[model samples]
Target: MHIHKLPDDVLHGILQHSCYFQYPDFYKWKRLLLLLSICKRWRHLAIPLVYNRVYLSYYDQSEDTSIVDDEPVETIKGAKTKTNLDLFVINNCASLARYADIRILFTSNAFKGLNQTIERMKSVLKTWSGIKTLSLTLVNDVYFVEHQVTAELYDAAQINQLTKELYNLIPGILNLRLKGSRLDRTNKHLYGKLAGYYNNQLKQLSSRHAIGLSDNIYFAQISKLDILLNSENGYKLSQMCTTSLVHLNIRGVPVNYRWASFKTNNDVEQIVFPHLKTFNISYLSSTPSVDRTGTELYNNGRLKIHFPVLTKLHLWSPLGHCELLASAIFPEKMDTFDVLGSSKTMQVLSNMRIPQVKKLYLNVASTTSNIRHATLQLINKILENSPGSKKNKLIIHEDSIQIDPAVIEWSQLTLLHIGAQINMDIALKVIAKLPNVDELTFYNFVAENIPEEAFALKNTSGCHNKLEALNSSITKLMLGHNELGHSKDAVITVIKYLSVRLESLSLFGAQVAFDTDMSEFVNDYSHIYPNLTNVTFRLLTAKVL
Candidate 1:
């Protein structure tokens, strides 16, 4: 005797609970079909679920024809008449419409009962006003018409008419994606017409601006907007819109182009940027000459750009321009200014006057005296300006500047990034001299050069309150790639002598030898080097037991 099967509603609940929508392509229909094929009870529920996403255009006949007597195929007289998805949707119009979700797609062939397809969709489109989503796509195959007596001719107007009619019929569409195949026309008024239509729409909008759509988006709410700019129209388009834009990606803004010319008073007197947070200019080819020299000439030319509330600015170029932008656009309101470069932006950081900068990153490979001097001056200014401030922070890359032992002692530097292998000599010298240096980052330097007495330097085992305060106040300590290869014991012994106030450690590319006993080292080091969280190995492959 067979047990009674569950009802259709119960089966749907079971499927829905299992997150059937997530893996729609695989499980939605597969499981349903498999279960239904086993017995009639499951089939009834499975078939309807499978038919929910039916493509109305799929039933439309494939227009295939074998022209006779050298007659060209695709001609109205010679075209093959095939059943289309539209026809199938129309035949079962009432039943399919009642199911709530019906997708209709149209083909390029206007003669193949295409009008009949649109006629069938009117009821469904009208009745389903409460439909959560509606997507209408008009895809047309580009075909060139050729006759024996005349030159090649193509009729694209027919396809355009159908699309225009369908667009006008839909009153309230939440989500719309239109790929108008042959929308590009030589006529000038066409773009203005399209822009007017888009500006009046209430729904959220995004469209390709090549056909002059970028200059016309006046939508009330545009959270994410992306626009492409060329040398020809970058300034004009920018001057028109971009008042209330939040997130912007400005790519291909011609480097040699002149924006200063727009500084003229031929138009609005006030330079307008009411609200703009994130501004990223990736590609720049502009290289303003440095020879035109004076006080803040370099500063004004570079650092004097306008960004009232800009927190993050990513300029992908050499250090010179970066320095210029940072110094010019160094808003007193900015907190995090990250400079990622091929060489360090020491000069950029140095020349700029950033009084309110809390966190700073300078990632570059090469450095010069001008840049170094600029960096030193920048740091001096920050310390001078923010004497009693607690929130300001600085992080400089390896070998970016020459740190005079005296300068570190005189300034109010709480955090220091020394991207060099911690030598007993330098550590003794730095710790002894810098009374205010609380946090220190020892970057990867040649460990072989670190004199054996790095941690055991007796000239100054104990220094000022700041050096003594390091064990308590210091929060981060980054240890560069300085390995203790064959002599793991020596490395372990060295760490045992390190100050206890160290909080975080970043070991970039240092490897501990495989044959050594790490258990004793781990236990001893963990106890001595308390508050260690991140232990990273850059290019080492060894399982840690």
Candidate 2:
């Protein structure tokens, strides 16, 4: 029967059987063997086992491919044949998969002539028009062919011709990952030709070309983009700005400059991605590559580039020269924001005008003894800077962190988390302040940390019932453990008043996403907290251990 005629469930079964999981497992091996079998049994067997997923490699355990270095296509005089050859070949007698991986390993003169080899490879590649995701790798090796020291891989003209041929073979390819070699000899021509062949089916693209992701592929229709940032690029971000882009990931080691010694701020006017939503900037190296100081990224108020629709921004561990990158693009205003960065890194953004946000997470990372002080100070700065978002429901991200409720807008906060450094007086003050909190989490919640005002009275007055006077609107409460360990009884005593109005509470655990609208984050983390249904709604006092 024709492929489209297959029932939906049967087609899904075919895809499930052909998909490649971790390496080549039993199912993959069986499928490969069944593909090679020429008996009548093959008549009833599914053809998708071979055509649904394909991995063509030369330096692998399966598949046959050759790699060569071609810079304008040069030929060394007098090729020698004295070299050890390692080979793996899989002939493609039929067309293959929705996902295809081709790793070309160029060998010595032992392989067929360039013309013959490329023709053969092209023939095999021609059958894979169904591929939606394709990963292409080119491997160049230097060998002693009779001590000639040959590094010649293949003719560039031939490879370019092959790439042109591949246009028809993989026209439906949507996701393309290119590594080791540039796909186009003329660069833009081949990429543009491929884009035309696929009819803009390619939405996501990544490259590890020798020069990085610079000047490799150009297609304005691209929705997701990954850029290789280095000192050489020095922040001409306009080249990457496309109105269709929804996500952007920038990362790379400095090619010729160290961030510690390099001083160059981004050209703020060079970026204006109008429809972009998520922007991430980080480094891919062993050394910590953050800018030397906040001043390094400051442009002295030159031009303000804006991302009109940007919502999610994440700056991971190390940023070589991409520090405060969002500040360059997300200038004065943006709606529905999610920002994650250090206190020092975020200090400059304290005045960003965010009218509203769906989620806001701050790491407040520090190596000092007063992390609580830094965390509180940063939170206050953010709340002061973002008046519009002070009333928006949001979720916070941090494995373990503290908070100061002094500057917070109580009614808008859906989640409240405090650390060991909080005073009992301040903790009780939070209960009185939170008139609309849906969830509350406390880490290192020991009684000694609470001031006497919570359980004591004036020397001349009666015992103050401050704990019972609490009016918290919290629905879910989570009590987390501390690194140094805390007295359980002390924690129970402190949370009893806060839990008075809780609908469901989980002790010694945290649900980072609570019950808010960030469904993706919440769904994965909802199971982290222990049994909440079993917990009786009685004031968490003298609670079952």
Which lDDT values do the candidates have, in the order given? 0.40, 0.46
TM-score (all chains, Cα) for each model: 0.49, 0.54
Model 1 regions more than 4 Å off: 1-242, 249-270, 278-317, 322-374, 386-424, 427-443, 449-476, 482-517, 524-545
TM-score leader: 2
What tens digits encode model 1's per-residue C-alpha lDDT throughout 170-270? Answer: 43334333222233221112222333344444242223332333444454433334434333333223223335546555554443333332122333222
Residue range 321-372, candidate 2, lDDT tens digits: 2345433556344544544444444554564554455455444333233443
Root-mean-square deviation per candidate = 12.4, 12.2
* Model 1 lowest lDDT segment of ten: 184-193
Q: Report how far off residue 380 is in candidate 2 (Å).
A: 3.9
Model 2 lDDT-worst window of ten: 80-89
lDDT (Cα, 0-100) at 313 in candidate 2: 71
